[model samples]
Target: MKKIFILSALAFSLAAVAQNQKQAMTKPKTTPNKAVVYQVFTRLFGNQNTTNKPWGTIEENGVGKFNDFTDLALKEIKDLGVTHIWYTGVPHHALVRDYTKFGISNDDPEVVKGRAGSPYAVKDYYNVNPDLAVDPAKRLEEFEALIARTHKAGLKVLIDIVPNHIARKYEGKTNPAGVRDFGADDDTSVEYKRDNNFYYIPGIPFQVPTSDTYKPLNGEKNPLIDGQFSENPAKWTGNGSRLARPDINDWYETVKINYGVRPDGSKDFPQLPEGFAAKEVKAHFEFWKDKDVPNSWVKFRDIALYWIEKGVDGFRYDMAEMVPYEFWSYMNSAIKAKNPNAFLMAEVYNPKEYRNYIHLGKMDYLYDKVETYDKLKEVIQGKTMPDPISDIQNGLADIEHHMLHFLDNHDEQRLASPEFAGTPEKGKPLMVVSATISTSPTMIYFGQEVGEPGKEDAGFGTHSRTSIFDYIGVPHHQRWMNGGKFDGGQLSQSEKDLRDFYKRLLNFTVSSPAVPSKFVDLQKVNREHMSYDAGLYSFARWSDKQKMIVVANFSWLKDSFFELRIPAELIAQWKLRDGNYVLHENLYGRRHALLKVVGGQGTATISIKPSESFVFTLAD
Candidate 1:
C-alpha cells in the first residue's frame, strides 16, 4: 500500500510539472474587482473575557452584540480592503439560552450543541438571533441597522442560508405575513410525501444519546437540562443518517430539510432541463415559473428573498452540496432577478459538481477548499510540494474566477494553531499564494490577522476552530478589540507587526489592478536556478497597464539568495528586448533591480529571507 501511494504521488508530481509548463506558455485572463471577504463570528468579535471556562454560559462569558460593530470597527475592516463582510451566526438558531420572555422559543438543552448553538441548525429563518441584540426584542432591527452601517462603510454584507437543514424545532415566528411555517401542511401519515419538509422515521421517538464524555451545559444547573427531546417520529440527521437514536457524534440537533428528493434517492420534482447550464438567470426562473416544484423549494426561495429584501447583499450557503442543484437554480435565479449583482457563494466540496453548481445554479462562487486550500494546507505543513499550485489553477482554469480562496473560516482551524502551523508568520507565504494566485475572492477570518491560536476549549468545540457553539471570548482577538476600542493597544510588538503586514498586503491587493490580471507561474521553469526548492514559489501578475512579480518563501528555517530567471514566454509577453529594466520591490523599499533582457529572457538576483514574500513592480 505504501509503495502504491508513493508511486501515485510521483505520477501526480510529474503530471503537475507538465501541466505547469503548458500553462506558462499560455496567457491568463484578467478579472475585475477581485473580492476580499472579511468573515467575523458576530457573537465573539466584541467580547473581552480572559477566563475561557470550558462550558461557559451567557452570564459567565458574555457574548458580543450586533451594536458592537461600531463605525470605527467597520471602517477598519473596510480600510483593510475588504469588499464584503460575512457576518456569521446572524440568523436565529437553536440555543440553550432561554429568551421565552422576549416571545422567542427556548431550545431543548438535550438537543442543542452547547450553551450557544450550531449556527447551521437554524431555528427561525426570518428573524435574527436574539442573543446578538442589545435587547432581545429588537434583534431584527439591530441586524438591519448593522447592515446599513456596513453599507455606509463601503462594504457589502453576507449571511448564511442553510438550505439543506433546519433545527429540530423549526418555527418561523417573524416570517412575513401569508408565509406558512415548515411542516404546517405536511401529511404525517405517509413516510414519503413530496410536500413534506422532513423525512420521518414513522413511529420512532427521537432519543438523546447518552455519552460519558459529554453533557448538556457541561453539567451546569439548568431547569431545561433534561435528557429527552420530543419528536413524534424521528427524522434523518443532517448528514443523512437514518438512525432514530443517532449516535453522540451525529448532528442530532438538526433535521434534514427535504427538497423533493424521495427516500430512494430519486428526484420527485422536475430535474433541470438539458442545456440549462448555459442559460441566464431569467431563463432559469422562467423554466421553474410554471413547473410544479415541492413546497420546501419555494419555502427556501422565499426565505432567501426575505433577507435580500431586508438589505443583505448576498448569502453564504452552508453544505450546499448536500442540497439538490435544481433547488439552487430556482432559488438563486429568483435572488438574482431581485438583485442582479448579489454575491451567491456556496460550500461545495466535490470537484465533479463545480461547473454544474456555478453555471446551472447561477452561483457566483464556490469554496475552493478541496483543491486549492487543501493542497496549500499540505504545503504549509511541510508535507507536500508547492509545485502543484499551477496544477490546481490549470485544473480549474475554466472556472478559476469562481473559486473562493481562504486560509481560515468558522469551520477551519486558526492558521497559527498547534494543529496547523505553530506560528502565525507561516501564513505569510500561504496568504500571498491564496490572494494573488487567482482572480477569485479571498477571505480572512476575524482573528486570523492577529494570530489567534484558538486554544480555548469552549464547551462543545475543542482547541482549533473558534467556538460558535459556546458563549466564550477569543483571547488573542480580545487584545485587538482592547475593550471595545477595536485598536491594537494591548497587542505585543510582534503581534502588531504581523497585523501591519496583513494590512499592507490586503490593502495593496484591493487597490492594485494587477491582482485581477493574468498570472504566470515562474517557479517551474527556474527550479534548478540557485538553491530554489519546493518551499520557494514565484509568479507574475500583469494587466495591459499594470504588472508585478511576486516571490514567496514558505520555508521557516532557511534564508537563501537566488537568481530568478524570468521565462522567455513572460519576457516576450511583456515585450522586453535587450535594454535594462528597473524593478522596485514592495517590502524592501527603494531597493531596485536592473533586469537586462537577452535572447528574450531576464534575470534578477533575488534575496528572500525565510518566510518572506516580495512584490516587485517594473519601474521601467
Candidate 2:
C-alpha cells in the first residue's frame, strides 16, 4: 500500500509540472507600456494674451517663447500622463517678423502665410524659429535648453520634418561644417534630373497667385507685400501645380522637393525588393548602408540625424505619403541606427497605403484618421451606430498596433467646436474608446482636456480649426495656464472636472495590463443573445493574470441597462470554471458587478450612464 501511494504522488507531481510548462508556453508575451502623446502647438501653449485680434502681429497677440515652457509647466504636463510632447512649429520658418539684423534675410509677405508663418513652410533646417526665442540671436541655444529641460522633466520630445516641400525662398544660414543648403548645387536648366534638388520650368519665372478675397497681411501696407516676389526658373508648387502661375488654392507659398521621381512618375532611385516589406528595419538599413541615393534623400537624412543629435527624440513626418516609400526606408533606417527606439510617425491618409508606409517605409505609427477617427466622428454626431467599429478593427488586426489614434490635432477640428460634437462632455466616452480600444498610442491635442473650441476667426484661418498660420492665444488652454502658473487656477468647475477625468483616464490607460493584452469583440455575441443596443459597444481584453470587460455608451440622451454576456469561447480561453466572480470598475472604482459563469458562459448585469464608460476588472 505504501508503494502504491508513493507512485500515485509521483504521478501527480509530474502531471502538475507538465501542465505548468504548457501554460507557460501558451501565455501571451508582456508588451511595453503604451505611449500617450500630448501634441502642443509650441507657440500657443504658453501664451497668456487674450487679445485675439484678426491679422494680429506677434506684439499685438503675444507669442509663446521657448523660455515660456517653464519647469512647472512641463511637470504639470507630465503629471497629466503624457509620455511624449510634440512641440509643433519649432523649426525655422518664413515669418513676417524681422530677423534681418541677425543675418537672416527678410521673407516677402507675399510668400508667407500669416504674420506668423505656416510651420510646414520651413526656411532653414539648421536653425530654430527666431520668433519662439526670448533672444532671437540665441534661438538655437534657447531651444536646446528647452530640450534639456523637457528631458529633465522625464518626457520625450518630438518635432516635425516636412520632407516633401519647403518655403519657396529656402535658406539655411547655419548649416553644419560639411552640409550645404538644398538646391545650392542643382542645375536649374532642366525640368528633371537624377541629382537635381528641385524641378524647374527653365524659361519661365514664377508668378504670385491671385485671389479676390485673400491678400498678404490682409492688405496691410508693407513694402514686401507688392504681390510680386522674384523666382527665376520657376519651380513646381508644393501641391504639384506645374503651371508657372498656380491657382490661389495651390500651395503657392512652398516649393516641392525632388526625390528623383520625374514628372512622368518614374523613379530614378533603386526600388525595394519584392519581399522587402516583410523584412526587418535592420535589413532595410543594411540595404542602404553603402548604396548611393538622390541628393534630396541625403539632405533630409542629414537633417533628421542633425536633430537627433540635438536630443530630439523623434519626428512627425508631414505628408509622408507624398514622398517615395523607398526614401522613407532609407531615412527611417538611418534614424533607427542612431537611436534604436526612435518614435517615427507620419501623416499618411490613404488607407490603401497604410501597410506600405508602416512595413516598407519603416514608420512606427500612422494616423488612424480615415478608418477609426472618421467612423467615430459619425457615431458622435449620431449619423451612424457603433457597430462598424468592430469591423474596422478586424480589418486592420494584423497592423493595428501601428495605428495611432487621435480625435483632435493641428489638422482636425476641436471636439468642442460648433461643427464637431459641440460639447466637452461628449468627448468623455469617445476618448475612452480611442484610448482603450487597442495597444496603439493615444494622442491628445494641447487644449483637448479643457475643451478649447477653435472658434476664434484669427486671420488666414477661420473657425472649426485652430489657426496654424497666425499668432493667437488658445482661450480655454490659457485659462488652465492661469498666467503661466500651469495650475488650472482660472478654470471653471466643470472644466476642472473634465480635466480630472482626462487625467484619470490617461494614467490608467498607460499602465493597465489589459490595454495591450488579447482583445476579443463582445459586440456580436451580445447583440445576438442579450438584445444589446446599437448605441453601445462592448469588448473584452485579458491576459493570464488579468481580465477586463470594456463597455462604452455612445448615446447622448439615454442611459443603457443591459445584460452584458461573455461567450463560452472567451470563458474557456480565460480558464474559468463554474463560479461567481466580482468585477470592480477600474476607472472610478465606485461600482462593482457580479459575473456568474454557468455551463462555460458568463453574464453580468451592467448599467452605464449616458456618455459614460466602464472598465471592469476581475477582482482578486
Winner by lDDT: 2
- The reply for model 2, stretches above 4 Å from the true place, is 1-32, 529-531
- Weakest lDDT window of 10 consecutive positions for candidate 1: 1-10
Quality of model 1 by C-alpha lDDT: 0.83
Per-candidate TM equals 0.93, 0.94
- Residues 1-620 of candidate 2 have per-residue lDDT tens digits of 00111112222244444343343222223433789999999988888888999989888999999998999999999989899999999999989977889999999988888789999999999998998898999999999999999999999999999999999998999999989888889899999898888899998999999889998999999988776889988999998999899888888889999999989999999988899999999999999988889999999999999999999999999999999999999999999999998999999999999999999999999999999999989998999988889888889889988999999999999987878877888877889888888889999999999998899988996788889999999998999999989999999988898888888788877777778777789888888854577789988877666688889988879877778899999999888788666665666655556667899999987777778887877622
Which stretches of candidate 1 lie above 4 Å from their native place?
A: 1-32, 587-591
Write model 1 residue lDDT over 37-137, tens digit each, in one string.
Answer: 99999999988767778887778888899999999999988877689999999999999877889887788888889889999999999998898999888
